[model samples]
Target: MGNQTSVNRALTLINEGILSGVDSITLEQLAEKLGITSRYLRELFKTYVGASPKQYALYQQLMFAKQLLHQTTMPITEVAFAAGFNSVRRFNEAFAQELKLTPSAIRKQHAAGSMKVQANSINLKLSYRPPFNWAHMRAFYQLRAVDEMEWLGDNSYGRTITLGKVRGYFTAVHNSEQSCFDINIVFTDTDGLLQLKRIVSHIRRLLDLDADLIEVEARLSLLGNALPKINTGVRIPGVWSTFEAGCRAILGQQVSVEQAVKLLKLLTAHYGERVTVGGQEVLFFPSAEAISKAELTELKMPGLRKSALRALAVFVSECPDSDVEQWLKIKGIGPWTVNYVRLRGLSAPDCLLADDLVVKNQVLANISSDPQESELIDIIHAKDKAAIKSYYLEKSQLIGQAISPWGSYLTFQLWSQQ
Candidate 1:
């Protein structure tokens, strides 16, 4: 088998390429991007992913094309290009060979007429497993949402988005009856059509629509009674990108969520791009270049934090593909900040934010009710940062092991208690 780290790194890059609508990426190009040989990548995929790199990419592209054919009224040629096929003939041949039916047959069976399409937008349904606590998810976004950048309605949530050079907005309405989100996407630029697959992938990550909560809750149940009954439908609500999540984490330090939201609003107002989509004015979260270049005097936070924010932006701006571990080298960024980025930014399944204050309090509350232990908690609270970090680290190791691979869910469950 290939080195585990290299194998994982390769897979992540491949998936990222697929999501970003780079349909034309050859296996050689993918290998070159990872600085590995194509033979090594093929071996890695065979051992871990059960297919060659080319086969996997083709499968994903075909699936995306199938979804578009079934869901949208776009012409077959458009669907072919949007899903990354070079020509309509190749798309049809692959569709026939893989599924034993043409795209037209699948579309006719599914019938796209059921979906509503607006003047400048396309509507698509994103599916997820049932027992989703959408109310909880909605409340989470509603609380931290920034004006102009995000909005929440009675049964829907909408936000502005920036994907590469394309800027637009989308609204995802909760369809509990259908166990899906009916999303309407409006792009200011026509490149949105070409980027349809990538946009859908981002929305899936942003809403966490593909998580298997049944298995997650089953494993988290191993934590026993330490947490309140595992909340059903609890999933890690993710941000649009890791850089955005890192910035939010840095700004959120030592402040309430409300205060953090205020800071985020100020940061957005100053650095984010402004665009009008479908007659609504929206702001795209500032890019790393924007944040790295500005002085950020508008933010009223401590000087160290503003410095940290700019440092992170500069790092991301320069090294867009670097690992999150590299962030620890920055001055103000720490374990909590990095893990927060992993949990919410990347939607990583195994991230345990043992260093978060709220997570620490919840864990402490669950493990003990004794007055002496409470006094110890008080003492730890009064002690230096090192002491507090040590205490939580030791305590978390006990439960953190039992909840392997689902620590992010456990973190959210603990947060839901407050």
Candidate 2:
């Protein structure tokens, strides 16, 4: 048991290093980041992940490069450099060796069958392991979507995105036949591969693209017959930026979800940046720098929530290497808010929103046999609320551990319940 735990820890650290240094990371630097020798990192990867660190990184680069080739009209030279290849010849050689096809051939094949979109946009097919519940995903985003920034239609979901100074929009429709999401991204700049990679990564996180649904289902099945069975492939929704998630969490502290969305819309409308994409106006979420410096006296929320928002913005803007502990340091940031940010913003899979009203109510409903659901809910909120909350938190933690690793998904499943 001890050895297995140690291996998991080591792999997690090494994976974090790789993810944080995808564009230009060397094996030695990755090893240093993991506080181990390069040889040990190589052995660990070979033993567990079945690939050397360099091989993994190279594969990622090649895949991203291939996506760019098939999705955009970028020149071969630009694609080569953008994909982090030292030269176009190296890129061409790598493509031939890895994919057994020339870059031009792949592009030509894509052109023959790719979806039509604006000339300035790019389209990529993002695949997921199957059994994904597209209806649940659509409803989840539609319910709490902020105005102007997000859109959820009959069979599609999309949002305007802001990554640093670059702003763009992406619309995605699920291709059930292929078990993939076909996303069209329209951006203002195509400067380098780094930005493109970041945008794709953000989208993957937002849409829960990389989840192994089979494994998640298997783990979650341990909690008896308690989950929302109809939506077995439900995914935990993710925010585009940590700052935006934090602000939304703070805004939602004491209000219902609908009220919180209203406040968020007001905040964004008052402070966010407006950009035009495909002849439509979209507002980007307000930046932390702007929030931290602005006088937000006009916001309709109470003083404490306003203060919390500013403090969160200041912390996120000033401390780039943020953690839950740093977030907890803010005056009004509680465990629920912090965990909400962790789950949705940072895409941490283990954090559960234990203190949320809906979570507590749903958990109580699952555990208790009381037919009077409303009566039980009133008891929870009436007197001895603190004790009841503590009991629910303890039970929820135990249940969460039983589900382990996939607690975020479990939380979403619980949320999906009536």
Candidate 3:
């Protein structure tokens, strides 16, 4: 692994060690997966990834262990084993060896007793690679806010979302929570504590927290300070429930945000389940099953819209276990709608909803009120030939990568200007 190419190959292998799927993969199995001699792979990985494959695996487990320690009511032994260690003793030994502290010690450090869960919420910090403009980002959130479900006020953005059947609320205090963003979660179930870590991870993506800002700056250098100051890589503010996101998307079709929000509130007040918490009326996003069966035709929405919304409801109802993104297959549920839901609802880090007016304008020579699916077809519709082709080529690559890990923020930057 001395040459540049060999170094690249080994680095590729090491980077492939994603945090997911580590629980089931053993060191011996990973060696086979990398197709290198296990010992050599071990030595090279330690030199490159800064840890042996076994150690890396343990590091991943320790991260999971940390998640449990902070997010769950699980016993330390159970947290150890669930993180894939064979026993509590082994987990403690490894925790001490790698982290230089026992699992119990870490748990005590963040204990509910020691740390206050203010306003009935736990504060969490999300890390990011940044050139973030918090002022601009908050302004964007303020513009697109929905009523009751999500709102921007009191110098914070707050909303309630449904995770599967579980309902929870999050409030983002722009500066108070931690490094990039601080969010507090108030949930219905204590079991929800464990789920918060993954939710936090998704929120980071939705916000484009992990984006490589240096690369982003390079790509947008042509836009000069307009983009950097404007926050082209701003993150997508996410929703907890895909159902709520779907409803919001449906309401947003060809309408002003205020109008769309009014319609959404009408729908929720009519169909969404009501919960009483902290003296506020919190409405759960309507489930597919509920939407499918309920009489939401009361909204008097257009027939196409009614059908689309109904289709979304039935889709959500049928596959009760699948994510809302997985269940969105109604005839009118095209790329735009699904992509919107993914961006905001499912917390997809890089989905580009092509139907968005912002995305279209950002990637075009001249702005149209629309940048539809047909725009993608216009490669064949090149009437001006060379000039049009050159124009498209210049902007196309940037457009494609706009949403890769930070598209929502890109969208945020564009919309904030509006």
- Which candidate has the highest lDDT of all? 1
Scored against the true structure, residue 168 in model 1 reaches a CA lDDT of: 93
- Model 2 Cα lDDT, one tens digit per residue, 78-191: 667656676778788888888898888887877656444444577778888888888888887898897789998887899988766667889988888998888888877554
lDDT of 3 by residue, 187-279 (tens): 776544434444555455446565576775455454432243454445556665567678788878888787886777777777777786555
Best by TM-score: 1
Model 2 residue 293 CA deviation (Å) reads 1.3
Q: What tens-digit string does per-residue lDDT give for candidate 1 at 1-418?
A: 1265566556545454442344446677767766789898889889888988777777878888888777887778878887877778888998888879898888888774646445468888889998789889999999999898998998999998887787899999999999999999999866777777777777887888878999988888777546747778898888988999999999999999999989999999989988888888889999999999989899989999999999999999999978787899999999999999988887877787877778888877775455556644675568666766676677689777788667889999999986
Deviating ranges (above 4 Å) for candidate 2: 1-47, 70-73, 96-102, 105-111, 114-119, 192-194, 225-230, 370-391
Among residues 3 or more apart in sequence or in different chains, the pairs in candidate 1 whose N, CA or C atoms overlap within 3 Å are: none
Which model, 1 or 2, shows the larger lDDT?
Answer: 1
Error of 1 at 293 (Å): 1.8
Better of 2 and 3 by TM-score: 2
Report the error of model 1 at residue 302, Å. Answer: 1.2
TM-score, one value per model: 0.89, 0.83, 0.68
